[model samples]
Target chain A: MSAEAQTCPALDAKELDRLRGLCRQARIDLLRSIANAGAGHTGGAMSLVEIVTALYFRVMRVDPARPDWPERDRFILSKGHSSPGLYAALAARGYFPKERLSEFDVAGGMLQGHPDMLKTPGIDMSTGSLGQGLSVGIGMALAGRLKGLNVRVFVLAGDGEMQEGQVWEAAMYAGFHKVSRLVLIVDCNSIQLTGRTDETLSLAPLAGKLEAFGWRCVECDGHDLADLVPALERAVAVEDGPVCVIARTEKGHGVSFIANRVEWHAKAPTPEQLAQAIAELEGAK
Target chain B: MAETGLTYTVYDADHMTQAEIYGAVLTRLGGERPDIVALTADLAKSTKIGKFGEKYPERFFNVGIAEQNLFGVGAGLALAGFTPFISTFAVFTSLRAAEQVRTDICYQKLNCKIIATHSGVSFGQAGTTHHCTEDISVMRSFAGMTVIVPADGIETAKAVAACCDWEGPVYIRIGRGFEPRCYENDQYDFQIGKSIQMADGSDLTVIACGPSVQHAVEAAKVLKAEAGLSVRVLNMHTIKPIDKDAIISAVHDTRRIITAEDHSTIGGLGTSVAEVIAETGKSCLLRKLGIPDQFAIVGYPDDLYNHYKIDADGIIEAANAIMGTELEADEDWEDEF
Candidate 1:
C-alpha cells in the first residue's frame, strides 16, 4: 500500500490489480455507452478512463451514497466532452446504477452530453464549454477554505482545451492567489477535434507555461497507475500554491485502431467495432 | 431600517450612487450572512465592490481583469453553497462574459447575484466600449435570470439585500455614480418582478427604469402643472418578469404609452413594454424614448441622456406626441395584427 492511498482504502498489490480490472471494465462500459448513444467523443473519453478511475476509485474522498457530502474532496471534469469516461467511472464506483450508463446524451436522462452537476450526482461542477472547469475549481477551493473544511479540488482538462484564453486567466488567478488544495490535471492527449493540437495550436512548452504562471508543474505517464498515483499524491501534498500535473497521454489510448486517431475524436463505434474494441480491452492484461 | 431590515437612509441616498449603495449593502450583508461572498474582475473600486473587499479581505476575490473567470468563479462558489455577489462593468458582465453568465451560472441556475455597475450610458464619458446599453436586453433573454435595474441608491440597496433571499441568478444593473435620488426612503414596498407606481394618471403612461424613473416623475409633474395632462409614471425596475398587469392596465385606461430608458431602443425597457402592449391586442399609441440604434457619443451621462431623448424633456416630448395620436375606435381585436 502506498502511503498516499491512506485517505481511502490502501492501494496494495491486490487493490491495484482490482483497480486495473475495474479500468478495463470501465473502458468497455464507456465504449458500449458511446456505441449505444450512436454519438460521443470516443477518443477523448477512452483516453480519460485511467485518470477518472484513479480519482473515483482511489484518490478522491467521495461517497457514492452521499453525493453532496460537504467534506468530500471535489473533482471537476473540465474536459466535459469526455463525459462518457466520467459517467462510466461514477457508475463503477456506485454513484448511479451501471445500467443507466447507456442513457448518455439521451433527452430527459440524468446524463447530459456534457457534465451537468445538477443532474449527475458525483459531478462537482457542470462543464461542457472548454477552459471553464479550472476557474470553477478555484472557486470551490476558495469556498472550502472559507468554510474551514478539509477538502481538495481537482480539475481534469483536455490538452486541447488549454487553448482557451480563460484557462490562462484562471491559471494566472490561481497562481497569484496561491489557491491551496487545488490541483489541475491536464490530459495532454495531443490531439483535438480538427487534428493534432500541435497543428491546431502548439502547446509545446506546456509545463513551462504553467510554471511561469507560478504553478508547481509535474509530468507523469497518465495511463500508468504507478506514475499517476504518485503524481496525484504529490499534488495533494502541496500546501503553498496551486499544482499542475501534466499527464502525458495518447488521445485514443487503449484500442489499437482508435489509439491516437483524430477522426475517432467524436465518432461512435459500430456494433462490430464495439465488439472488437471490447475484445481488445478484455484481452489486455 | 424598515421592514426589509436594510439601513439605507434618505441622507445616504443623497450622497451615494446606486453602485455605492450596492457596495455598502453587500458589505453589511457579508457581516450578517457568513455564506455571502463577493467577486470582481479587477473592477472592485470602479464597481464599488471594493467596500466589501476592504472589510472582508478573505471573502472578497478580485480575479484581476478577467471577467470570464470572474463569473466562472462566481458560479463555482455558488455551486459550493455560497451566495456569490459578482461585480464588473455592465459591458463586461452582459457582453464580454455573456456565455459564462449563460452556461455556467444561469444554465445551472446557481445562486449568483451579478451587480453590474455603469449600465446603459451611465459611464457615457468612457465611450461606447464601457457604456453598456445592451445588458437589459442580453440578461433578460436568459431563462431563469432575474433582471433588476434599480431607480436610485435606496432602491439599489433594497435590491442588493432582497436578492439574497431569492434563489437562482439575478442581474442588478446600476449607474456609475451621482444618479438623482428617486425614493426619499426605503419605506415603499419593494419586491422582485413587481413595478412601483410612482404616480397615477389617465391621459398618458410613461414607463421608465433606472434614472429614467426620476425623469419620468419630474416630467409627469411638469405635464400635470403646465399642460394639464395627467401622466402615469411606473418605476419598471424589474425588466424580466416585468409588471405585465400594470402595463395592460395602463394600455387600457390610457390609450397612449411612452417608454423612457437610458438604453438603446433595440432591446431594453422600451422593448419589454412594447412586447406586453403588442400581446395585449389593444389599440394604444406606443412611443419609445431612448437611444435609437447608434453608438452613443462620448459625453457626460446626464447630457447623453438628454441628447438621446431619455430624460425628462424627452419623456415630456414623447408624452405630448403620444397623446395627440388617435386610438382606433373599433374594439375588434380579431383584425389587428
Candidate 2:
C-alpha cells in the first residue's frame, strides 16, 4: 500500500478496486433505475460514478451511523440532476436501505428526482438549481473553519454548470480566503445537456483557469483508479489554498453504447438494454 | 400607593439614531458573547457594525463587496454553531443578496441574524437603487424570518442583543446616521413580536415603526397641542407577527388609524396593519403615510423622508386626514360576530 493510502483509514487499493466494481454496478443500477422510471440523467451520472465512488468509499470520513456527525466531511453534488449515481453510492455505504434504490423517483420515495438534504440521508445540501451547490458547500466549509473543526468539504461541479457566473464568484472567494480544506472536483465529461461544452460555452484550458484563480490544480484520468488515487492524495496534501481536481472523464462511461454520446445524457435504458448492461458489468466483475 | 415598587426611569435621550445604538449595543454584546461573529460586505464602516468588528477581530468576517457570498458564508458559519450577525446596507442585503438569504438561510431555517443598516430612505443620497424602502415587505414575506425595525439607536442595540436567543432567521433593520435616540437606557424588555405603546389617546391612533416611529411620537405632541387630536402612538417595531391586538383595539376605541413607516406604501407597515384590520372587518378611517408607489428621487435621507411624507409633518397630516374622514359603522357588526 502507498503511504498516502495507508494514512487514509477509509481508502486502500482493495477498497478502490471494490469501489470500481461498485461504480460499474452503480452505472448499471442507474441505467436500470432510470429505465424503470422511464426518465433520468444517464450521461452525467455515468461520468460522476468514479468520482462519487472515490469520495464516498475512499475519501470522505463520513459515518453512515451518524449522518450529521459534526466533524464528518461534507460532499455537495452541485450537478444534482445526476443523483442516481449518488443514490446508489449512498445505498452501498448503508446511508439508507439498499432496497430503497429501486424506489427512486417513485411516488412518496425518500429519494426524489433531485437530492434533498431534508429527505435524503446522505445529501448534505438540497440541490436541483444549478450554480447553487457551490455556495452551500462554501457555507459548510466556512462553518467548519469558524468552529475550528477538522471537517473538509468536497463539491462536485459539472463542466456545464461552470457556465454560471456564481461559480466563478465562489471560486474567486475560495481562492481569496485560501480555503485549503475545500476540494472542488470537476467532472469534465466535455458534454452538457444540450451539446458539446466547447460548442455550448468554451471552458477550454480548465486547469489553467483554476490555477489563475489561486487553486492548486490537478488533472487525472477519472476512470483509472491508479491516477484518481494519487490526484486525490495530492489534493488533500495541499495545506494552504483550495484544490481543484479536473478529472478527464467520459460521459456514460463503462457503457460502450452510451459512452461519449450526448443523446444518452438523460435517456433511460430499455429492459433489453438494462439486461445487456448488467451482463457486461457482471462479466467485468 | 405612595411609593410605586421599584419605579424605573425611562430616559428620553435625543439625537442618536438607531444605527448608532446598534453599533454601541453590538460592541457591548461582543464582551458577553464570544460566539457572536459579525460580517460586512465591504460596508462595515458605513453600516456601523464596524464598531463590533473593530472590538472583536477574531469574531469578525469581512467578505468584501460580495453580498451573495456574505450571506452564504454567514449562513455557513451559523450552521457550524456560530452566531453570525451579517451587516450591510438594507438595499444590498435585501435586493442584491435576496436569493442567498432566502435559499441558504431562511429556507434552511439557519440561526443567522441579518443586521441591515440604512434601511428605507436612509441611504437617500446613494440614489434610487440604494434606497431600501421595500425591504420590510420583502423580508416579511420570506418564511421563517423575524422582521424587526427598531425605533431608534437604543432599540437597535436592544434588538441586536435580543437576537442572541432568537431562534431561526432574523432581519433587523436600522436607519442611517443622525437618528434621534428613542430609549434612555436598556431598561425595558424588548420582545420579538410585541409592540410598545408610547402614548395613549382616544381620538386617533398613529401606528409607526423604524425611523418613522420618532416622527409619530413628535406628531402626537403636535396633534395634541394644535389640533386637539389625542393621538395614540404605537412604536410597532416588530413588523412581522405584528401586534394585531394593538391595531384591533386602537381601531375599536379610536375609530381612526394612521400608519407611518419609512418604507414603501405597498407591503410594509401600512399593508401589515391594513391586513389585520381587514381580517377583523372593522371599518375604521385608515391612511397609510409612506413613500408612494414610485422610486424615490435621489437626495439625502431627510429629503427623501420629507418627499415621501413619512416625516413628523407628514404623520401629522395623515393623522388629520384620517381624523377628518368618517367610516360608516356596520349596523349588524355585533350580529355578525
Candidate 3:
C-alpha cells in the first residue's frame, strides 16, 4: 500500500526496545527545552511521549529525509500544546537536525508556540485550536481514498480538550464515512487546565460512547510501549470503520513531583524542579 | 439534476436569483476540474449546492449541521491540494465559524472559497437570526480575505468563475432569491477588486453593492429623466480591496456622493467609501443611506428595503438630499461619531 517497506513490523521485540530507548531520551529532550525557555507546557508534552514515539519510529511508514513524500503516513498533534513531545520525536526520527530543537521556546520562528505546517517540515497540519485536528485527519484520509493511496492518518487528541463540541462533530463525520486508515489516540492524561476534565464537563463512559458512534475502541497503558504498540496495530487493521485508542496516561509522566499534579498543566519547571526531573529520568539508566 | 423544488423561471431576469447561478457554475466547475469539491453544512437545497451534489456525488460532502467543522474540513481539504467550496448561510459562516475561518483558513491563507448565501435581509421574514446584515463588516476585517458581493444572478456566475483562479480565501455574499438582474448579460469582463461604472454622469455619484446596485441603477435612470441630474452609478461588487481610486475620482468629479447597501452603514460598503473620502482630504457632501445601526423589523425584503430607504425611490431621495447639503469645511470635523 505504501512505497516504503517496513523493516520494523508490529510486535517486533528488538524494534520495540530500540523505540523505548528513544522515548526516554525524547522525554529528556522535552524536559530540557521547555525548562530552557523558562516557559511552556510541560505536563501534556511529557504525557504524550510514548504514543508519539511509537507512531514516529516503529509503526508509521515514513522517511525523515523526504517529509513530503505523497505516500508517507501523517501524524497530527491535535493537542498541539504537546509540541515539545512531537518535536523531540521528529528530531529522533531525523525529520530535521537534532540541533533544531533549540528553536522551540520563547524566541520562536522555526517552531512557533503552536505547531505550524508552514514552519515545520514533518508536521502534516497546523493545529493549536483544540478539536480541529481530527477533521483535518478525516480530510487527508478522504483525499487518500480518492487518490487510491494507502496512506495512514494518526491524530493525538487530549482527553481534556474533548469538551469542545467540534470534536463530537468530527467524530460523527469520521464514523459515518467509514474512513479507513485513520487512527485517533486520545491521550487521556486525566488532567487539564483549571481542573480534571470530568469535573469541568464529564466525558466518562467515553469508550462506550465512541463505540456507539461506530468506532472500534481500545484501551492501553500509554507509558508502556509494549502495551501501546500492539493496541495501535489493532487499530490500523480495522477496515469497517475508524479506531479510537484511549491511552490512559498520567500528566507529567516522567517527572516524579509533577506527575498527576494539577499545577504542572502549563507551568514552567523551576531550576530545582528541572534538576530533580533530570535525576528522576536519569536514574532509570 | 434532480428537481428539489428550488427551480424558478428566468422570466426576463425578474424571477432569477444569484443562488441559482451559484449552483449552476459550481456544478460546471466540478465537471471541468476534478480538483474542485463542494461542501454544505446541511444546506444543500437551501443554498442550492445540491445541484453539485447530484452531479458529483463522489466529490460532494454534506458535513451535516456543523458549520465550524465545515470550515475546518474545508481548510484540511485545501491543504490536501483540493479547491474546496464551502456553502452555507452568511450568518453561520461569519459568526459560528469565525474563529475557524480566521485561524484555520485566513491565517494559513488556504485556497478555499466560502459562498455565503442569504446575506443581508434576504431572508427577511425569517427574523434577525436568519438575516445577516453584519457579514460584510466582519468578513472585511480578516487579512488576506477577498470579499465580493454580486448584484444579481449574472454577476454571481461571473464572480464565481473569477474566484476559481484567484488565490487565497474568498467570501462571495449573495441574497436568498430573486435578486433582479443588474447586468444585461454575463458576457462583460469582471475583476475581483475593481468597480464597474454602470452609468456615467457629472452631477453626483451613487455607489452601491449587492442588492442595492440594481436599485441604484434604476434610480440613476429616474434621476436623469425627472430631476435633470446627470448621475454616475458604480457597482462596487468587491468590498475588501475596494476601488479607492473610483471613490476619490468621484469626489473630484462630483463633490456630492451617496453610498447604499442592504446592510448596516457601520462596516459595509458605505463605511469603506467613507474611509477613502476622509483619507484623501476631500470635502464632499457624502451621505450613507443604509439600515441604521439596528436590527431590521421582520417583514418581506421589499417592505424592509422600502422602510429603510434602500429601495429605488429611497436612493433617489438620498441622491437629491445630498446635492442640496453644504460641503464640510476642512477644519476639524464637526462630526457625529
Model 3 error, position A267 (Å):
1.0
Candidate 1 lDDT by residue in tens digits, B92-124: 999999999999999989999999999888888
lDDT of 3 by residue, A1-285 (tens): 233565366566777778778888998888877887777789999999999988887788888878888878888899998899899999888888888887887565587668988889899888899988888888788877877888889989999888888988989998887888999999999988988888987889999888877888999999988899889988987887899999999999977888998899888788888888888888876
Output the worst ten-in-a-row residue range by lDDT, candidate 3 chain B. B1-10
Q: Please, what are the lDDT tens digits per residue for candidate 3 over residues B1-337?
A: 2122223234434654688778987887787778888889999999998899999998899999999889888887787788889999999999999988987889878899999998999899999999998999999999999999988877787788888889999999998988767876545667889999999989999999988898999999999999999999999999989998898888877888899899989999999999999987757878898889898899999888888898898999998898778775545543421
Error of 1 at B172 (Å): 0.6
Model 2 lDDT per residue over B43-85, tens place: 8788778998888887787877778778877876776677788
Give the docking tier of candidate 2: medium
Please give the range of 10 consecutive residues that has the lowest summed lDDT in model 3 chain A.
A1-10
Ten residues in sequence with the least summed lDDT for candidate 2 chain B: B1-10
For candidate 1, write residues A106-151 as lDDT tens digits: 8888888898888888888888999999989999899988999878
Clashing pairs in 1: none
Task: Report the poorest 10 consecutive residues by lDDT, candidate 2 chain A.
Answer: A1-10
Residue B208 CA displacement from its true place in model 2, Å: 1.5
- For model 1, what share of native contacts is present? 0.75
Give DockQ: model 3: 0.66
Q: Give candidate 1's total backbone clashes.
A: 0
Identify the candidate with maximal TM-score. Answer: 1
Residue B260 in model 3: lDDT: 89
